[model samples]
Target: MNILCVCGNGIGTSVLLKVNVESVAADLGVDVNVTTSDAGSAKGTANMNDLVLTSAELAPELEGT
Candidate 1:
């Protein structure tokens, strides 16, 4: 599975989410390829990933992406 963790700048928040996602997927014994991306970049890359995770503040912008 490919999972994307997105944030405003693609640095801090996204990176943190990526780590947490990886940890939980590990605990669940699910193999996943997780990555971090910014809101703008995510818009273009979202389709390439299986899942896109982000904060509520950014959710609307990413909807249907």
Candidate 2:
């Protein structure tokens, strides 16, 4: 699975979330590729991702994906 973890800055919370997600995916024996991005850039870059992780405010933007 391709997962994109997004935050306002793309360097702090998004990186932390990516690490946690990878750990959980490992524990579950799931193969996943996680990437991080800022909310503004995520929409343009998320086309390759299968799932998106972001704050509630950003969720609706990804709904159509």
Which digits, one per residue and each the tens of the lDDT, describe model 1 over residues 1-65?
99999999999999999999999999999999999999999999998999999999999989888
Q: Count clashes in each candidate, considering only residues at least 3 apart in sequence or on different chains.
A: 0, 0
Write candidate 2's Cα lDDT for 1-65 as tens digits.
99999998899999999999999999999999999999888978887888889989777876665
Best by lDDT: 1
Among the numbered candidates, top TM-score falls to: 1
Q: lDDT value for candidate 2?
A: 0.90
TM-score of each: 0.95, 0.87
Question: How many Å off is the CA of 47 in candidate 2?
Answer: 2.3
Say what the RMSD of model 2 is: 1.4
